[model samples]
Target: MAEAEFARPIVTVDIVLLTLHEGRLCVALLERSAQPFLGVPALIGGYLHTDEDADAEAAVRRILKAKAGLEGIFFEQLGTFASARRDPRDWSVSIAYFALVPQGALKGAANPLELRPVEAAGELPFDHQEIVTAALARLRGKGAYSTIPARLLPEVFTMSELQAIYETVMGERLDQSAFRRKVNDLDLLEVVEGEKRQTERARRPTTLYRLKTPVAVFDRRI
Candidate 1:
């Protein structure tokens, strides 16, 4: 093989950070600080620091922390993008990742970080809109049979709040009875003792609950 053909491609990491805001799904984006799309909205990303980062995951963690002021978020590798024209600089490949964080966690993040509704997000630089779309699809698909969406909620939540989070991701209204029954059967939640929440519409305080286990993958879709 020709040496030119074997030249290593530039590698980068991009993260689609998602959180729920005002009952809508939102994604965190950063405005590019340098050229090659200067001042344009883009996913939080950077070239992999081979000397410092131990792996792709480590690179993503560093990128999120530096760009979004986020750490210890629940993230998973969504996929990779290697389109020849994706990057204007050179032949590059980006290992894409998606993270879920509770909105409360981002209370004091740094400036230039914007959280826009996923559906209303305008054109993003370098196929980033496509990446966010793929991430949302993965999240919704996984929500059906897994406990992934629970990560978007606080440590303690009411069943109604849990159901609302699922509904927000699924983009549909679920049958309350059926939803509760399915959740109960999964054995994933534990009731919080003597804890309840009262909303303006509710005459009584609703019991609070939390996940009994971190992750749950159901054998059948609920």
Candidate 2:
């Protein structure tokens, strides 16, 4: 008797949907309904269809929509996870795609499309914890030297709010003076002509600002 070899490999597509919710970095997670991890939280994913092309983008869109009931979102290929023992059921290789969406957009949706903040370290069923860690590192690295961080911000926000978002994502407190200087030098923000009213605070409202232009830089080394 000899060991048997399979004719084909099992391929899967996993999605890591990332977003900023109320100044906290969050990711969309789903509860798995199948075996080998049934009832545990997993990224929205599925087996690749034979009829469909091996195009990662198309596969991710299909999986995201089917699992998360989400569509028309932006995604970037993170990397492939092909460990021989990553999946227990069979020999499976998963291609990971990371999606970034605005917070509050998918709130109260179907199938537990809830957003969980990435700030606190928690338990993730699969290799999702690794995937999330890598994705956040990429985002932080890209934010320092690029304008991708702006995407996580709103259409109009105060300078403090902008800094807060960045600080939260970077997991570090930034020097207020230095932060303002860097942002102003970048000239990426356009001062909106109005101030946001703040009733809770005893001080006056701060001026609001918007992104001056769309960013073309895509280098992930922020």
Candidate 3:
């Protein structure tokens, strides 16, 4: 006897490409070029290609490289959003991924992205707003105690700059001494010997540091 079949849902990956610009957390969006929502801004996403993609991650990498011209950027799976009503075309399943990148990286990409402050991304189509909210929650939750926040900075940055990024992600001020102590205790950074840079906060040369690992998690919050 033959088994009953279920309807296949539309599988895709949506990227929440976030960055800090002018001290504000922003997300990248693109104008829909096709029908149903043509000319309207939406999150960068694409349908999964079974013949070409090895998996969802491959699809995401392909989409980002194709649409945003981005490569070797850090991103993690935020969550899955599957529902019958999210898309007008069909039942949709979106494997959402999020990344925090430096502003300069966007500038260097061959295809520049349209960015909007997270709070102002504004009434996006398809369940994108929900996906964005989830991504932000994950970032804020992991950002408090890990080197994850440093992903927003350049390859190497001053301690002040790292603290500023943390404050930005956490949406509050952090004590300079305390923050420095926490960072040192985590041992997540390595000082760049003979390297110093001037920041807007001061004209004096400041110590530069780089993450020892891509990311690290602590049992406690900073």
Candidate 4:
């Protein structure tokens, strides 16, 4: 095989940081600081440090903290995007990841990243729109049968608030009675004793609960 046929691959990591803003699902996009697409909004990404990053996950953590000023958020590898034309420089491979954070988490973010609705984060650079689409599919697909959607909620919340995040991810209204029953059946929450919030029904205060685990998978869809 010709040596030129196997060009050195330009490796990088890109993250899709998601959160709920204004009751809508949104993603964080950083304005590129360098020339490939200077000043353009794109996914949070950077070159993989061969000497520094212990692994791709390590690279993701480093990039998220360095580029987006984010850390300790729940993240998972989505997949890899590699193509000769994906980058103008050379053959490349992007180790893509996605993360979920609560809406209030970014209130103090000092980075240049801005939230854009998943439906309207248009024309991102370097096949990023495709990466976003795949990440969204994974989120909504896993969300229907797991507690993944709860990651978008604050540390403490009412059942209504939790259900609202689920509805936002699923893009449909769920039956309140059935949804609560499923939540109970899954044993996903533990009551925040002595904490309650006033709801539409002023006579009775709604109870608040916190997730019992990071993610709980149920057999049936929500």
Candidate 5:
């Protein structure tokens, strides 16, 4: 193997932070503060600090906090993107990750973070649109038959709210009765005592529940 072939590539961590906003699936984007694409909307990302970051996840966490003012959100490694022409600055590779959080959690800092509908976020820099598409596919695929959709809800929520989050991510409507039955069978949630809330459309207060555990598992029925 040639030494040149083994040369280290410029590595960066890019995050696709997703949330439910105004009844739509939204992705968080940060306007680039420096060049290659100055002032252009891009995924929250930065060069991985070799000495400072212990791993790619650590680098992602630091970048999210620094760029998006986000922390403690549900995130997972989506994939890796590498193309010689991906970055105009150099030959670069990016470790891509996706996170899900409730819109309420992002309230104060969303000013700097542009929350665009996933379908409408066009032409992001450095293969980012491709990255976002991958993340969306992962979310929708896992959402069916997994507890992944719970990450987009508040700690306490009614079954209707849960269904709404699922539908929003899946980009389709689910039969309410069937959805409730499936959720009950999964046993992923536990009812919260003395916690109930009613939406404007509800005739009565609905029972609230929270996840029994954070880890999501697949269910064959879904």
Candidate 6:
């Protein structure tokens, strides 16, 4: 007897949610629209198109734009999953990706569903809860040594704002003197002239600083 085609090709996309909320790192969560865990909270994702190119990054980007109507986000491939039973559907393998998008950009008009940001401890639906946990953990690790947090900031912001992002991701408060020391030592930022905005407080207005180079300019290891 000839061998039958026992398994089918499985393609899917998963997006990593990143945002700043209440001076903390927040992740986007959604209610599942279909079965396998219908109505449960999870990250936004969908199936891939077989007819399209095999570029995993591009595929995820398209899904994000189509589903969330967001673009120009800093996305990176976390890894791949091929667990025989990861998906209840006939042995499907998925390429998992994560993204870092500024909070303001999410307000774009193209967005369909209200992508809400979640803070504090909570449970997410499906394997998605695990995916978000893992992705955030990875980003936190990178945060300690890399400038990934800058991706969550505006083009120009105060040093205090930058420090707040790091503290939010790290889930703790940082020392003012030391934090300033670290950023200055890194030499990763460039001060922009003029256009300074004052804060609600009566203290001296903080100067706005912008990234000196693209993320690619920095070593992956930090």
- lDDT comparison, 3 vs 5, better candidate: 3
| Residue 167 accuracy (lDDT) in model 5 | 85
Model 1 scores a TM of 0.93
Give the lDDT of residue 9 in candidate 6.
57
Tens digits of lDDT, candidate 4, 1-222 = 898896589999999999988879999998888878889999988999989999999998888777767788899999999999988778889999999999978754556568899878889989999999999999999999999999998888988898899999988999999999999988899999998888885579988999998888889998
Clashing residue pair totals per candidate (backbone < 3 A): 0, 2, 0, 0, 0, 1
Evaluate model 6: give its TM-score. 0.85
Candidate 1 vs candidate 6: the lDDT winner is 1
Q: In model 3, where is the ten-residue run with the lowest total lDDT?
A: 104-113
For residues 107-163, could you state the per-residue lDDT of candidate 6 as single tens digits?
543433434444443765446666777787888787777788888987888888888
TM-score versus the correct structure, for each prediction? 0.93, 0.79, 0.94, 0.93, 0.93, 0.85
What ranges in model 5 sit over 4 Å off?
Answer: 1-7, 108-111
Q: Candidates 3 and 4: which is better by lDDT?
A: 4
Please say which candidate is ahead in lDDT: 2 or 5: 5
Model 2 residue 185 CA deviation (Å) reads: 1.3
lDDT of every model, 2 decimals: 0.87, 0.73, 0.87, 0.89, 0.86, 0.71
Model 6: lDDT of residue 213: 73
lDDT of 3 by residue, 92-171 (tens): 89999997778777764444578888867889999999999888889999999788889999898988888888988888
Off by over 4 Å in 4: 1-6, 108-110, 199-202
Off by over 4 Å in 3: 1-5, 108-112
Angstrom error of the Cα, residue 158, model 3: value is 0.6
Show the colliding residue pairs in model 6.
41-125
Model 1 per-residue lDDT tens digits across residues 157-211:
9888899999888899999999999998988899999888997768999898998
Give me the candidate number with maximum lDDT. 4
lDDT of 6 at 124: 57
